[model samples]
Target: MSVLVYTENWDGKFKKLSFELVSYAGKLAEMLGTTVTAVSIGSVDQAELQKLGNYGAQKILHVTGPNLDKLDNQVFSSMIVQAASKEDASVVLLSNNNSGKAIAPRISVKLNAGLVSAVIKLPVSLNPFTVVKKVFSGKAFTNVVIKTDTRVLTLSQNSFELIETGNKATIENFNPEIDTGLFKTSVKDVEKVTGKILLTDAEIVVSGGRGMKSPDNWGPIEELADILGAATACSRPVSDEGWRPHGEHTGQTGKIIAPDLYIACGISGAIQHLAGISSSKYIVAINTDKDAPIFEAADYGIVGDALKVLPELIEAVKEVKSS
Candidate 1:
């Protein structure tokens, strides 16, 4: 038996998230004294498929087929289950991103295995199958134990460090026997957001809230983000107020991101908003109220009007960069 990791690619290229998942799986497999197998679906090149080896994938399975560009839950789960069976995988690992969240449950049912999401670290113990994850809005930790023989886990983004093993993976063109009749819908074309840093993959993020006063005042936040080469995000209310797009909203009910640095400007740090960004490595808060809930969670905080403070912050960043 081995550890199998499912990797996702964007436009025939693997994202850092895919590498992180493989790296986590590799470390886990090492702890268990097993090999690591990575599965990639789509039209990823052989050279691109081999990149998983840098993170410790001993074997890479590349699957290609018609209409593979579109993601089908049944097709994805079936392929993953079939790949796991071929590898006799004792554990299955994937990213805790949108696609992973959608397919992990179905794979668990197919394998009759216990599943865990947002796993932060390698298993603490193997005997009881113990894993760690944050709970209560990242204020508390919980140890979960899976009793099933086969296990499925979704690794939280940015929670684990990446490692290169300097070993090359054996790439094999994998063809899983799946029912073609499962393809009920066909996507004729795709539209992708270009020239923008995806919040999920961004290491640094700059977020604004209603405290910015109006969408017109978002200039400083965008400038800060551009200077830092970071993604831009917004609190839920900002989106609801039509000050920002819904895609940029981040909270318990919106996208969950764990970037290296999260700068919150004019945000009150509501519990719902904190839940999504609580896993960030460092948090910086700027608000007029020193007692704002955002300050309590921030590594660095500036108590002032965001409109007044943002310009200074932008200039400071520019100076640092110029220096």
Candidate 2:
């Protein structure tokens, strides 16, 4: 049996999470004395598929069809199940992103595999197949043992580092049987924000909150993010107040991000917001109130007006870059 990884692609390129999944699965395969087989859906260049070998994919199954270009959760899960069965995979790994969240549960039920979502580390014990996962919105960690013949795991994004093995993967064409009825719902149009780093993949993130006062005052936060080559994010209330897009929201109810450095500007640091960012390697909090909850969780605390401090911070960053 092999360790199978589902490598999802977007805009003809493999996402950072895809490479991480392959690398992670390869390690698991080595532990199990097996190989790693990668599965890809939709159209991607063969050269791109082969690059997965560098991340430990021994072989790749590319499933391409006319209707597979658009993401239909039902259709995608069916393809994954078929691919896993074909590969005789004992462990199946997927990134716990939007797409994975949509399809992992369905695939687990279809394969009758014990499934774990947001796994942070490799299995502590393989005999019982116990894995550590984040629980209570990143507040705690729990070790779960899967007592099943087959197992499925959805890894948390940015949890693992990708290591290249300088190997090439053998690509094969896989055509799975599909029911056209699954295509009843079709995507009409898609709009994506351009020219900004995605928060999930960002190494550093600069976030703003209600203390920024208004949406109009977001200029300094954006500037700071640009200076640091970081992504921009917002607290949940900022998005709910219509000051920021929902996609940028980070809290217990929103996206969970684990960046290297997270700078919170004008944020009070509610428990829910802290839950989302608690995994950050280093947290810097800039707030007017020293008692703000965010300071309690911050590695560095700056008690000042964000509007005044942000501009100076941006200029300092610019000077450092120039020097």
Candidate 3:
């Protein structure tokens, strides 16, 4: 039995989630008494795949071509299926991010495998493998057993603990045949967010909401984030009002984050917003309205105006960092 993890890259470099997924796949490999292999398809070089040894991948299979750079559902799913077939992978892992969400199900259909998305916990085996996962928009969890030839899983970001033990492995390059006709999507300009990490993968998040009053009032939020080495996020209303980018929005309809600490400033917690961040390890809520629903989900709640509270928080964070 072999476990294969699909690694995504950016600008010919391995993304952070690549190691995370490979580390998770290594655990599955240990359980199955097999080796962990990684499959990467993009413009990345074989050297990038070779570096996956740091994450315990025994072998890396890379397929690169001009058509592989852009996201083509048909071409990517086909290539992944080909890799799984070649590797004879029993369990296939992918990160439950944008790319994973799009490709995992398609690959599952191609492989006729059972899939578990948003996987939180590792497999529990009494007899068959039982994987626990979030369901109903993270309202509850259910255990699923993959009683099939292949088990496909997409691990949720920040769900599993990343383990590091230096193990450098060999990387092999294999080029797959891509029918240029199948490449429907074209590579265009890529836009990137600057000065902040993605909230989903961030360890700490400093979020602002309507309490900031205006976009200009977000200075303290950025300062606090910089001091704490955290990402900046916003509530739905703030994004709707165009005070912040939509990508920084965190709510049910927005990005869900499970950071170690989530500090919500000036945002009255609505059920919609709480649904996105309720999985965070610890929550700190600050608002002038004591009755705000956000306080219910917070580990610590402070009833005060955000305009007054933010400056103090920023100053305190800077002081601690300097000390």
Q: After superposition, how far is residue 220 of candidate 3 from its true place, in Å?
A: 0.8
Candidate 2: misplaced stretches above 4 Å? none
lDDT of each: 0.93, 0.92, 0.86
Q: Which residue segments of model 1 deviate by more than 4 Å?
A: none
Per-residue alpha-carbon lDDT of model 2 for 28-144, expressed as tens digits?
998999999999998899889988998899999998878777789899998899999999999989999989998999999999999999999889999999999989988789999
Candidate 1: Cα lDDT at 208: 96
In angstroms, how far off is 139's CA in candidate 1? 3.9
Per-model tally of clashing residue pairs? 0, 0, 0
User: Against the true structure, what is each candidate's TM-score?
Assistant: 0.97, 0.97, 0.94
lDDT of 1 by residue, 1-323 (tens): 99999999988999898999999998999899999999999999888888899999999999998878888989999999999999999999989998999999999999999999999999999999999988776768999999999999999999999998888999999999989998766777877899899998899999999899999999999999999999999999999999999999988888888999999999999999998898899999999988899998899999999999999999999999999
Estimate candidate 3's RMSD in Å. Answer: 1.7
